[model samples]
Target: MPDSGGLQSVEASQRPDSQVRVFALPPRDNAAATTIVDGFLEALTSDDPSYAVARKYLTPKAAKDWHPERQTLVLEDGPRPHSTDRANAEETGRNFELTGTQVARLDDEQAFQPDDRRYKGDLHLSLVATGKGKPKQWRIDTPPHGVVLGKTDFQRIYQSVNKYYYAVDSAAGSGAAGAQKRLVADPVFVRKWADPLTETVKEVLAGPTRWLNRVVTTSFPLKAALRDGTRSLAPDDANKLTVPLNKSADSIGAAQCRKMAAQLLYSLRDLSSSSVDEVELERADGRLMCTLKEGAADALVAPRYSEGTEYQYFLDAKSRVVRMPASGGAHPSPEPVAGPMGEGERRMRSLAISRDQERAASVSGDGRALFVASMVTNASLGDAIAHSGAKAEKDGFTTPSWDGQGDVWVADRDPKNRRLLVFGQGQADRMQEVRVDELSDDARIEAVKMSADGARIALLVTENGRTRLEIGRVERDHGVTDGDVEISVADLRRAAPEMEEVTAVSWAGGSRLVVVGRESGGLQQIRYVQCDGSTPTGQALPGLTRVSEIAASDTDLPLLAHSDDGIVRLPAGAAWQAVVKVGTAPVYPG
Candidate 1:
């Protein structure tokens, strides 16, 4: 069998203060010389009790030469004293031992023995005197098994012991025999203790563990470098790639890894900030249409006449600019009339055309009839029989008036009776009167307006130095029906107690109504009221103060209002843009 034993020599020298030291050294070519010196010193310093006797072989003077190296072990010799019993016996001449016998005894003590326990002790190193200088050498006899003769014998013996203790084969075998045999005398042992007995097994188990450890250690440092400072973990080049690893594992390097990570992070941020909804507006013929703009649903048209201009006829049943052919002009016409005047002519002649421009004018749904009123003429009606032809009538005494559908409602005063008049095509002679008995003797009707449907009417009546709103239902052919239809008497007191007189009243879409009143301060407030008899809702129209006239829409929402200033549209829902300032009073429904 080949030798499996290995020898490691450690050279060390003592310090000036005398301390024993030890260190390892590289191997020498001569295996026996290396083993003898290494093994001898190792046994001398070992914790075994047998090493005590082994130390005596070294000479005190010779040991002084052993000095420790800067990075190696050192050995030193100490004083040796004779036994007291032996010294005393020699002085007493007891003749216990002769000089020759003592020499023989010392030689026998140094003899090699296979079984004698004394000679089979541990080895030690000491300096011995040679020809010129002291040489370092080891004093060793043999183990109880006897000294091995050659390299083969030494390996066999060592292998036998190694196989017995660590279960490894000698250096003579194949497979890991060479490596395993070298480890027999190595200072440290390396072995896998558990299930992963192979190198591949150990690597697999360690991969994730090593990776996790590297991540934990580097994560915080990498974040700090990138965030708080200008340092970057990635390379300057956009195409550069790098893999992250720690000291414990093999170096990792991959291309484009950092670039890919950055892209992924940016994508996540963009996704988080995205929004998902839709929005729109409604328009018609380049005009934005809204229900709240005009008081009515349809767009508003301007009144036909300008301020201070007097018109001859009222709106006909169709709301066109037409006149009443039956009533003749009160003033002598330039053209002579062929017909003779009757007794009724004198009564109707009192209804002269007022010099003041018609303060109020409204057309019927079909655009054939126009209702006109003024403080001077009291009332002058017109009808538009054709596009150009018009007829005027001076028939009754009325003030602020309105036309709805084919019927006309007006605020009028008679010498015998003061009331509201409802007139229509053939029923002009049969006009019905609405008497407000609740008003005081001094109170009088200032303005009146009929709803779009002709089913409701609003009256602005002044009573007892205060103006009050009287909303009532309209009876067929008859004037406004009476009821507890008063929308607001208290609001009238608060807004305008002295001049609580109503200036203008106009119907909005449906049962909604707007009543304009003048305050003592000359300020005007337009009160919005619901004819359905709910709480009277009011809003002040600042621009429409002292409103001398009013009108309503027939088809869409009612927004048309006429005043002394001009024809204006008070759109519904309080929209400012819905107000269309017209050049003339609007022809309703047309």
Candidate 2:
């Protein structure tokens, strides 16, 4: 990941650490072979394409054979002391012992997979006499075969950024089976200070990363790239950019040209201090082909969560929907939502609201039934839609989650039907079941939240006595299922491998997530993690005494967690406050 000066919505004063260390220079010592091993490992993670700094500690032959890209082992914590054995000059130099808690690995192909376990290894090196008359110098005779980093360093150094790509268009021109072209986020990792505009286009032209290959597309032609000799695409006078395309992008139509602009505009919108409001494409000779405005692109590629008037919604002591000032004002008297679910005996175990906040979904106290209603205060609880068709023994449901497209998802915890189901716009009859058997035969989803942008779903699935966070990409096709448009979820992969037990999760930003979990031998914590399962090295939600349930939205403020102490919120730069002392399960509009 390049250190392009990119933007983040999360403010710094709220986090304990603002940056993480990615690589370090070798700490040289002639007598300590362990120091040589530590320096060698750090150099492998460095951005040097040729692995030069690391080579200073390695023999030329060893450097030539070692491939840093072969694998990246993510260890549990920061550096630790390695035991070294004294050497006798005649035999092998000595052996330095290394140990770690490895939570994940990225193989040679850059494919990331979870490997939650402990590792112990030895580095055999020599403290050899250069010549009979010279003092002996310690040098590494063997180095680890792959890159390895402790989890803390991994989070601090790498941040995930999403670049835009054309939607998997299921429908084409003139009513082709109810299809439309939209934008989907293609997440990539870059260092904390990457140049957003230049790096983004370069990455897009470089094509999708290994994880999302073929699942997305860009309008740029084959072998197309950001033309050379261009210093920057940022406009000096206004919020518009004119980007020069490589010669391969010479042949494109008007629609394709606009699509290209949409890709750029959306990709650049997440910059922390971006002024770019429009994007235009041009031939290498500087002929303008098409232009797109910020407003136009936003309408086409909806936000992960709608940025509406910020309101803090939660379930009061009486299990009713209520709201308070999001940024903390004179506390408004907590009031029930505009519907029957907010009153009556419809006690909610948990609640989820739509991005627009015009509708909501709730589960019963016993978790046996799911309900949905309009946001209007007068909507009757009796009139709320109910999902049918669950097997009698499998009637339990988890908290419902709403997506940008107005779909609500919930899991049926019934052992017989251990499946995830989606309800389109709260229509019970259109319920569609999603198969996730690959997660495990006994895996049952406990909690789930759909991303605001409709890209991924964060789920807490318990299998084989352990619960972990998995990010599931929603799969759709032209085919219909159970009277609803076809939608299934697969590609479930571990994110936050260090947390073996996850209780809750929510989208904190487009490419990031907030989760409630505990690391090995650690207390329960609320931490920020990337959607791809990567996390930034930072403090957990500050000033909260305890949290049982947490709520977050890109639509509203920072974070809210339901605790025994009360419903507390961590407003940026402020201590957690019991915002609404009466609410139990809390949530923001998705």
Best by TM-score: 2
Task: Output the TM-score of candidate 1.
Answer: 0.28
Residue-by-residue lDDT tens digits, candidate 1, 1-590: 55788776966733221122222232223233335444434433322222332233233442333221111111112111122234443322111110110000101111111111111123223223333554443332222111112221111111100000011211122124112211100010011111111211112112212111211111011211111221212222342222222222222122122222222221121221212111011121222111111111011211211112322232222222322111123221112111111111111111112122223333333222323333232233333211101232321233334333333455443323455555442134535455443456666665555543333456666666665666543433212553112211111111122234666555544434555666566667565544422222124444653455554432234344455444344444543222223223332321
Give me candidate 2's TM-score against the actual structure: 0.76
Candidate 2 Cα outliers beyond 4 Å, as residue runs = 1-42, 45-101, 105-157, 166-183, 192-197, 213-217, 228-243, 269-280, 284-287, 291-296, 328-330, 383-395, 480-485
Best lDDT among the predictions, by candidate number = 2
How many backbone collisions does model 2 have? 20
Model 1: lowest-lDDT 10 consecutive positions = 97-106
lDDT of 2 by residue, 1-590 (tens): 67888877966553225443345575454646667777777765555545678867765566677776577777877335475654444445667776887877666544446787887766777665545777766666676777677765555444456677754533224125323444666666543444556766676667665555534567777887767797555755778888888788778877777767877877777654467888888887778788889877666553445466467778888887887766665344666777765674677777888778888788777667788877775666654455434455335788888876677988878766667888766687767787663587767788888875455688888878888888877766555433334676767888887786887787776667788878788878888887666565544565344577888766448587888778777777667766666677778887
The lDDT for every candidate, in the order shown, is: 0.29, 0.69
lDDT of 1: 0.29
